[model samples]
Target: MLLPYAKPPPGDADHALLPPRSVPARSRTGEGFYMVRLLKSALVLFIGLHALFYALQNIANIDAAHGALAYVLSGADHAAYPATMFFKTGNPLLAWAALAVVLAGELAVAFFGIKGGWDLFAARSGTAEEFHAAKRSGVIAAGLALLVWFGFFMSFGAAFFQMWQTPLGTGSMEGAFMYAMASAITMLFVSATDD
Candidate 1:
């Protein structure tokens, strides 16, 4: 009597007999969405607070009949106006540059908050598949986040220069630190995600 035996298909035996390959599963939970939301909120709040502080400071100077720009420019020339060690009347261009840099940074922050919030909400509501399909692009969100971070760093330099030249009160210092923290946290979150 002859025994009949069947040969396994090529590659099938190798793949099937061997344990199935296990890939580390990625999470698509609401936790990630929540984290991004918190970060966005903090960024917006910080920008608003900082802008308000600056506005108040400028208002105070104007009300006091002291020329804010003159005070900023003429570092040590005006005895009534405090001298800023870093800024001098000769460096008017620097002051303007700093102002422009900060304005750009605030705008970038706003853009990020809007886009990130939209993405997070869509993802959390279980519409990620639809959202991803319509968008077919993470470029906008990623670009906004990058721009915000870049602008933040640029503004940090300008703010540092301003603080060195003019006295930034405790409130300003605290706000700056908070902004820095928020930026760092947002960057970390953006970098960790696949989308």
Candidate 2:
């Protein structure tokens, strides 16, 4: 029932929704907004720098890196596991191929992470949409990090090569795990909506 003096409801009011003229709450615009964006960028930058340095190190010490890869691939000192696993090889060509893959992956991660961080930093003062859009590179970098550390090192090196049996391999696996987790955490953090 409607009062005689009451006005009629909106013709398009088929559902209980906010009025078209209503203003949304100020969630994205705040003092903490820039800080959040900066933090995300900084985290990604750190990851990028880490990869860059690692790649540089490997390149600078190519002989050592090659030897390490050879040691792990050959499964030479794995006394406990008498049975040999597949892909175990002492071929220099294979060692070089593995190293090349690692270097390439690391460089890719570095490139994307650095670019993403820069993009996010540049868009810090812009609209929320812009900042969100800047996260694409960061996301790609995180994926590369996972592919390199988790997929290549952990799965192929540690498991397939039985690298865990050797001291050097154990050290390498630990480092790889750390890098993987760092990238994952950064990705999750960066993906979060800024409010």
Best model number under lDDT: 2
Give the winner by TM-score: 2
TM-score of every candidate = 0.43, 0.84
Q: lDDT by residue for model 1 over 26-144, one digit each (tens)?
A: 24445676464445434434443444454455445543313333343344433443534454554656555545554554555455445544554455333435433422122343344
lDDT of candidate model 2 versus the reference: 0.87
Model 2 vs. true fold: TM = 0.84
**Candidate 1: deviation at residue 37, Å?**
7.5
Model 2, residue 90: C-alpha shift (Å):
0.7
Model 2 residue 47 CA deviation in Å: 1.2
Residue 163 C-alpha lDDT in model 1: 27
Off by over 4 Å in 1: 1-93, 125-166, 169-173, 190-195
Q: Lowest lDDT 10-mer window, candidate 1?
A: 130-139
